[model samples]
Target: MSHWLPASPCTPPGCAVHAGPARRPVPAAALLLAGCALTLAGVLCAPLALSLTGGARRERLVRCWAHAVLRVFGVGVRITGPPAVRGGAAGGRAGTPGVLVVANHVSWLDIPLVAAVCPGRMLAKSDIRRWPVLGPLAALGGTLFVERERLRSLPATVRSLASALHGGARVVVFPEGSTWCGRGPGGRFRPAAFQAAIDAGAAVQPLRIRYLGGPPDHRAPAGAAAFVGDDPLAASLWRVVRAAGLTAEIRVLAPIPAGAVPGRRELARLAQSTVASDSANLPAASVHH
Candidate 1:
């Protein structure tokens, strides 16, 4: 593996444990079909939606589709946060500048979860542009692809992100650089993406994403939803389909003003620590281990 590609010690074998029993094959199969149909609908409609709409209309379209996708997979969503106000007095910076939405990398589901709330340009690894169905959808959504394996491409990527932010675009990024099982230790947030916020004078919106539901304890990670290590996308999809009552809870913490910290490293650390501390404070029964 390349040194630049972020990795986690959490592996498929170690994290496949589920919070609840699997759905019977018949029901799971039906859900799989419905999810596939919904996804295809999104791919076909996305271009037309983008061509005809802008601003809030486009956001609603994306958010509704993402919510439907999560529902089809039997994954519920619960969001808690201060509402984003104009000039971001409540959530972000004190200007009309764009907001940088950053979140923990957990599963492929994380993509839709983020979009369900903050619909905007996403910073994704270049390889996602080649995935079968998701690739087209992501492209249509204005994803900014990055060559994570190439150290030389870092500056260019940062510049592109800054340009987007400068244009008053809310850009979503997963700074872990890779996915991890939603349970154990997650990879630390990489500092590279934070540079764009610094350059654009944007507000940083840190989000904490956790997969909840299992036995009464509800402390275990939803292994079925994790897309980490060598787990294939198809396998992960099936696992999610078969899981019963899985929930993805999103917490949008207060946004840090642009230049709140001196450098990208400090900014990244601030965001990471914020997410970690929030997770630590959740009720022990609801917290993921």
Candidate 2:
């Protein structure tokens, strides 16, 4: 592994604890099957959806699908913060900038949860392009793949991201570069993605996601949904479905406008601090800006 590639120390044994009994194995199995069916549906319909729908309509479609997926897996969602700004709103306005959505990485569930609020082009590792089923679906959804291992490719990746934002496209990124166990602030927000926002003069929207209701012994209940270290995707999925009362609470912090801070490092710090605010209490959601 490249030294630059973000790695988390969280492992299933250390971080993930048994949240509860399966309750109903048959229901859990059915839900997992439904989730799979939905994913396959996306793969089959996405190309046509891309061709026929406008950005706004498509965003609504994606959001609804994401919500459905979460519901199927019995994960409830609670969102606190200002309502998400719809994408492509500034399409004809030359100077108006786009929004860059950033959040803490926890589980595969994070993907749909983020989409449930702000639908956009996701920044994913280049390896996702080779994954079965998901790879083609991601491409159809306009995901931007980054070659993180090759430091030489950073500039080109930034340029692509900038171009997308300049064209008034909302982009979602996990600035931590890896998933943590969701105990405290998992990892620092890397400054590279912030550079794209600065170059495009875009706004940054930071969201903090926490998983509620896990094993009482665990410090962070969010670990129940965490997919970190060597945790297999199948194991993570099974855990999420079997766990009882797993609610994903998303807190949307105030958005940092274009040119709010002088540099990417400062911009990244400001956003991370905003997301990390009130970590101890996990206080009520309120819009920061």
Candidate 3:
């Protein structure tokens, strides 16, 4: 609701519950074990859903599992802009093709956060496709896997993404290549995703995700992985929710018309600049991904 960025690295005083070097309200080992259990369940159930039903029903199940994971972590989302389209209708375009929704990368949490809110297929790195439990669930979620180093695979990846969009499925992509804290200016967004959008002649919807307020004890420091490994998931998430209530602003800027932007590079720059500028004004704990 509020957009002010709070001062970072501030120690909250007089809060007896959180007052010590070890401020984790929940034990880290237990939280991780729960996460692992949830992930395993998701992986096991996904295939059954896919085999029994096709199309929208399966997508809905994926979304449900994603939300379940988020809930297990005690995260709540506050979305701005129109409700995400169900059954890949492109925000209500009927049989018309769906738009390509591109966002910035923030943390590992971005996967569930975006998946829970947006109903669509995600283009993720190949490594995520190979993760033990999470990878299988993501695959069953209809994620498109891409190889970052294999340029030869780029055309096929683009075509696959385009086909999904053309088939009335919104494709979500993190064009920033990897996650960042979103503390300063945003990271450089890769142009490949924009290229996919252009190839499909689909409009590009730029989404800026800002995670406002995190646990006082969690040290987000610098580096990308710190946000995930430096703090316990449940404790960190609860701290954020207690302070900011898992509040996030999903700003859907005006869609850029297909072919209006000269090239993928230019389009990428435009979208990156838009998100970076908007997110810069959000809370410090807030990150755009």
Better of 1 and 3 by lDDT: 1
Order the numbered candidates by TM-score, best leading.
Answer: 1, 2, 3
What is the Å distance of residue 65 in model 3 from its true position?
3.1
- Candidate rank order under lDDT: 1, 2, 3
Query: Candidate 3, 100: how far from true, in Å?
Result: 1.0
Which of the two candidates, 2 or 3, achieves a greater TM-score against the reference?
Answer: 2
- Model 1's alpha-carbon lDDT is 0.81
How does each model score on TM-score?
Answer: 0.91, 0.90, 0.73
Residue range 1-289, candidate 2, lDDT tens digits: 5423887777788777655545488888888888888888989999888799876787789989988889888888888988865434423354566789999988888988998988889999897788766788888888999888898888888898888888888899999998877776567898988999999888898998888774545433545788888788888888888877788878877888889999999999998988887365653232111
Q: What lDDT does candidate 2 reach at residue 140?
A: 83
Model 2: residues >4 Å from true position, as ranges? 1-4, 87-95, 214-220, 283-289
Candidate 2, run of 10 with poorest lDDT:
280-289
| Candidate 3 lDDT by residue in tens digits, 248-283 | 445666667778788989998988887777666544
